[model samples]
Target: MQEIKLTDVRYRPKYHIAAKSGWLNDPNGLVYFKGYYHVFFQHYPYDAVWGPMHWGHVRSKDLIHWETLPIALAPDQEDGCFSGSAIEYDGKLFLIYTAHYNLKEDGSKSYQEQNLAVSEDGINFTKYQGNPVIKPPLANNTENFRDPKIWSDGQDFYCIIGGQTLDNRGQVLLYKSHDIYHWTFEKVLATSKVSTVQGTMWECPDYFEINGQKVLVVSPQGIEPDGEFYQNHHENGYFVGQEKEGNFIYPQNSFRELDRGHDFYAAQTLLAPDGRRILIAWLDMWEQKYHEQADGWAGMLSFPREITIEDGAVRMRPIRELGKIRRETLLNESTAQGQYTFSSPCVEVQFKAMQDLAFEFTRGFEKLSISYQNGKFLLEKTGYKQRKITWKMETLDVQILSDASSIEIFIENGPVISERFYGEGDLELKFQSTKDVAVKTYRLEL
Candidate 1:
C-alpha cells in the first residue's frame, strides 16, 4: 500500500475531527476528563483505506477547536484495537476497548476480547500488563463480541458490550468490575429473542438514563428494510424503556431511529460537566462513496450533540459552544421566493417558515431539497436518499451547517439529516413558497 499525505485530501473538513492522513471510523473512548474533552477513534495511518487499526487521539477545551495528540494504542501481535469507551477513575483515565485478533490473518481463527489501558496525564498511555480483562462469551464463536461501554453508579463499574449469539442474533452483554483490571460477566440484558428490531449483530452499545427513561442505543447490522425505515444498509437507533431485576424491558414498538441521515453511524455518548448527555458519531457511513480517499483522508466525526428524551423519543441539539465558530452574520431577514448566495461554502444557516415552504440548497448539479406541508417534513436529494418526519409545531425551524464537502441539517433540535456532497464551486440557496420566511446565515471561522 502506498502512503498518502494529509495535504492531498482536498475535502478534509476544517471544523470537523478528521484523521491526520488516513482512513478513520467509529468515534471511540469519548470522555471529559480534568477540564478537557478527549476523543479516540479507529484509525489506520498507512493509507486512506482500512488496515490494522490504531487508536487516534484528540482533545478540545470547548468542543469547538481541537488539537491532535499522538496515537494512543497500536496493534501488536493482535489484529487491531477496535471501538470502545473511556471512563475516569480515581484521578486516572481508563480506556476499555475491543482487541480483534486473527491467528492466521485470514480470520479462520479469530477472537474479539476486551482489554484495558490507563493514562494519568491524559496524554501518554500504557496498556495493562494483565490485559484481556474479559474473554469472548462463547468459546466456539469469538468473532461477534466487541465494543465495551463502561460507566458506574458510584459503587461498582458496569460495562455493556454488543455481541451476537451462535444462531446470529444481536445481544448486549453486561459485566461488573470492582477494580478496573478485573471483570465478571453478569448476564445478557437484551437480545434478538426479546425483540426482532435487533438485527443479527450489534456493533456499538451505549446505555444511559435521561428524563426518567432508560435508553439503549446501539448500531444493529443485518436488518432488512421495512417501509421507509432501515432502508440504509444498517441502522443506528435506540430503544426507550427501563431496567428491572438485572434485565432490560423494551417493547418492540418503542424502538425508534435516532438520526435520519445518509452518513452517520457508530455513535458514542459522553456525560458532560453540566450533566448533559452529549454524543458524537462517525460522520460517514461504511458503504458510502469515499471520493476523498483518493485525496488521502476518508472520514470525520460529527459535531458534538446534546441528547434529551421527550414524549418517548430522543431529541438531539447541537452543543451551545458551536457559536464560538460564528465569525460574521451573512443574512438575517425575511425573504420571499428567490435565489440567494452566501459568503462562503462554510456557513451556518437558520430558517423559520411563517407558512408552509420548500427550500432548496444546491451546488452545481448536486441538490438537497427540504420542505414542509400538511404537518410533515421531507428531505430529498436526487439519485440519493429521502427522509420524512411528522411535525405539529406551528413554526418549523431548521438549522444547517454547510462545509466544503458535507452538510448537517437539524430539524428543530431533534431529528437530524447529514450527507456528504462532493460538488465543486459556490452554494446557491433558493426558496419556493407564497408566504414569507425568516432566515439567518452566519459565516464560520474555519
Candidate 2:
C-alpha cells in the first residue's frame, strides 16, 4: 500500500462514490425519474466537515454504477441550503429546500423559509422567480423551522415541514397546494417534547401508505432521553397509521426505529415506478463515537430496503436486487441442525447457528435484536464508548447476521480486533459451517 496525498475528501481508492470534498449527510431527493435513479444529497464540498450545504447529484440506470454530476445547488444562491425534498411535476423535476437566511444583526434569529427550483434536463436546475415560495408561519410558537418533505396526493401536492415550538417542542407542519405553488397551511399533525434538557425539532417529515396503512416518518432533533423514544438522532423512523380526509390516526402509541445499528439515520422513502416502496437512510449516526472520520468522507447511505409491517413494527432490510451485486459466491452450505460460529467480517457463510447457538433466532438479526441460545450469543453492535466498538459489533453484525446477502458491511482492518477484520478480500460466501464451519466471501469489484 502507498500513501496518497492531497486532493478533496474521497472514499479511499475504492469505488464507493461520495459527493465532492466535504460532508455529505441525508439523501435529499431520491426518485426514479424517467428510467434512471436520480439521487440527490445534502453536501458540503469545500471541507471534510459540515458547513454551507448544497444539493449533490448522481444518476444511475442501475443503482450500482453511478455517475457524479456537478453540484446541483450551492450557498451562492442562498445563505445555507438546508435539507428538503424533490418531486417531479408536469414532466419537470422540482426541488423544495429550506433556504436558511441568518440575520443575527437584524434580530430575525436565523429562520428558515421554503424555496423552489425547477429542472427540465434533470441536471441544471433554475430557481423559481417567486423564490422563497412560502415563509415560515407567523405563529410565535415555532422555532428552527426547516426540512420540507413534499409529495403528491391525487392532483394536490402536500408537504410536511419540520419545526420546533418556542417551548422547544418538536412539531410537523402540514400544507396543501393545488398547484405546486401557493401552499395553504393545513394543520400541526403531531407535537412531541423529547426530553428535559433537549428541545425537540422535527428534521424531515414524510408520509406514505404501506399495505393499506398510512405511515408517517419524521426526523426530530434536540430530543431528551425518554425510555424508548429519542434514541438515534433523537430517532428517525415511521408510524403505521390510518388517515382519513388528511388527518392521521396512529392507534399505535409509539414510533419504530428503522435501523438498530449506529450508522443508519435520516431515512427517506420513495415508491419506485414499479410501485414498490423502497427506502434509503443516512448511514451515519449523529454525534457518534468510534467513527473513522479521518478517512475523509464520514457518511454512506444504507442499502435500499423494501419497507413492510411485521408485528406492528416497521421492518427494513436490504432489498432483493441489492444482492445481485454478489458477483461471486464465496461460501454456501446448510448445516444439519447445529451450533456454529462466525466472529469476523471479511468471511461469509450461509447457515444458521442453530437455536441454542443463535440464542433463539427469529430470522437472524433483523436490523436490531438480542437473541442468543445455547452457547452462541448474538448481539447487533451499535457502537459504544471506550474499548474498540468492533468487539461489541462482532458479537452481532458479524457473529450473527453475516449469513445473509441483504447486508454489505464495510470494514477497516484493525490489529486490535483481529476477530472481526480477517483481511481485505471483499470475499463472498464460500462455505457454510453446518454442525461444522463453512464460509464464502466477496469484494465489490469496481
Candidate 3:
C-alpha cells in the first residue's frame, strides 16, 4: 500500500485549514496565545471519515498561511476528545473540552463530562490530573452534553455548554469557573422550547458581544426546511439581542441563519485583542457528500470572517487581513468586463453591479452563477439549489474568495454565501450585465 500526499488531492483547499491526510470538522479551541493564532479542529486521523476524535492543531502568524502541528489530544480513557475552546491563563494555554466515555453497561450509550488539559509551550499538552472537572448535572438526563465554549472577564471564566433538556429541547447551559478546574452550573441561558422552534440538540454554542449587542450562535439539529432556510440537514444561526438579567432580549424578533450556504456548520468565534469578533466554521455539511474522501481527506474550515450587527441583524464579511494573500493583480478597471480564465484555484475577485448583471463562473460542469436582478441577489451552483436574497439597498458589491473546491461570496459587506464545487483543469469566469460594472480580480499566493 502507498500513502497519499497532499499535492495529489485535487479538491484540497489552498488557503483554508485542512487536515494533512484525514477527516476535519468543527473549528474548535480558537484562540490567540503568545503571538500566533491557534486553530484546533475535530479530527480523525485514521480514515477520511469521522471516527474516534482527536484535536488536530495548526497555528498561523497571519490567518492566511498555516503550519500543521502535532495532534493535541487523543482518546486516552474516553471514546473521543470532542469540541471545546481554549484560553491563555497565567502564561500557559489551557483547553476545556468534553471527554466522552462509553459505559460498559450494555455497551450501548455513552455520557459526556467536561475535562481540562494544560500546556506551557503550546505544542505539548498533558491532561490535567484532576480530570472530568464537571459531570452532567442531575437535571439533564441525556448523554448529548458537549462543546464547552469558554471566555473570561478579567477574573473568573464563564462557559456555555450545549445540551438537551429532559423534554428533548435544545438548551444552552451556562457555567462559571474560577481556575478552569472547578465549575458551577449557572442556569439555562436559552432554549428552543417554543412551539414554532423544532431543534432538538444544540451543538457548538458560541456566545459573544458585538457593537453592544449580545449574540448567540448555535448549530441546531432537526430544524425543518423553511423556504431557502434550514435546507441543510442541520442549521447554524444566531439570535441578536440585549442581555437583561441573564436573559436575551429578542430585538431582531427571531433567530436568523448566519450564512446562507450549503457547506457551513458548527461555527466558533473568538474576540481578538484588536476588538474584532472573528469566526470560522466546518466548511462541509454533514448532509452533503464528501467527494474528496476518496482522495484521502474530507473537510476544511471556512475562511475567517468578521461578525458585525447592522440594521438589527447579524452580518458577516471576510476579514481585511485576507488582502495580504493577494500576490498579483490579474484584473483591475471600472469597465473591466470580459471573460477571464485561470489555472490556479486561489483567486480573489471584487466587483460592483447596478440593476441587472450576472457573473458566470464555470469549472467544467460545476457552475457558480451569481447575478443581481431588480434588487434581488442570487447565487446558484451546479449541484445545489439556488439562494435568492433581497435587501433594501439597490446596488450589489461582491467580493469573492475561491480555493480548490469552494467559493465564498461577500455581498455589500454584509451577506456571505459559501458553496463547494469539484472540477479539474482550468476555471473560466464570464461577466455579463446590462450595466457597466467596476471589477477587480487578484490571484492569491496561498
The model with the greatest lDDT is 3
Q: How would you encode candidate 3's per-residue C-alpha lDDT over 1-446 as one tens digit per residue?
A: 23234436788888899999888999899999988899999988877888889999999887878989999998989889999999999999999999997776787768999999999999899999999888897876478899999999989999999998877778889999888889999888888855136478889999998778888888998787776667777888888777998776664327788888788899999878798889999988995788888888889999999888887787788888988888889888776367989988789988887767788888866888877777677778887777877754567788999888999988874567878877877888898777688888899876
By lDDT: ranked, best first: 3, 1, 2
List the RMSD of every prediction in angstroms: 2.1, 7.4, 2.1
Pick out the ten consecutive residues of candidate 1 with the lowest summed lDDT. 189-198
Off by over 4 Å in 3: 1-7, 103-108, 195-198, 251-253
TM-score of 3: 0.95
Please write out the lDDT profile of model 1 over residues 1-446, one tens digit for every residue: 55468666457687889888898999999999999999999999888889899999999998988999999998885789999999999999999999998668565777789999999999898989898999987542337899999999998999999988777888889999998789998888777653345688988999999977999998988877776677677789899988888689998655577888888899999999899999999888888788788887888889889888888888887898888999878888887677888646788888888548798888766788888787777888856857776665566688988887788988884468878766666789988666778888898874
| Deviation of model 3 at 9, angstroms | 2.4
lDDT-wise, the better of 2 and 3 is: 3
Would you list the C-alpha lDDT of every candidate in the order shown? 0.84, 0.60, 0.85
Cα displacement (Å) at residue 151, model 3: 0.6
- Runs of candidate 1 with Cα error greater than 4 angstroms are 1-3, 7-9, 103-108, 139-142, 193-196, 385-393
> Per-candidate TM vs. native?
0.95, 0.78, 0.95
Looking at model 2, how many pairs of residues clash? 31
Judge candidate 1 against the unseen true structure and give its global Cα lDDT, from 0 to 1: 0.84
lDDT for position 191 in model 3: 83
TM-score of 2: 0.78
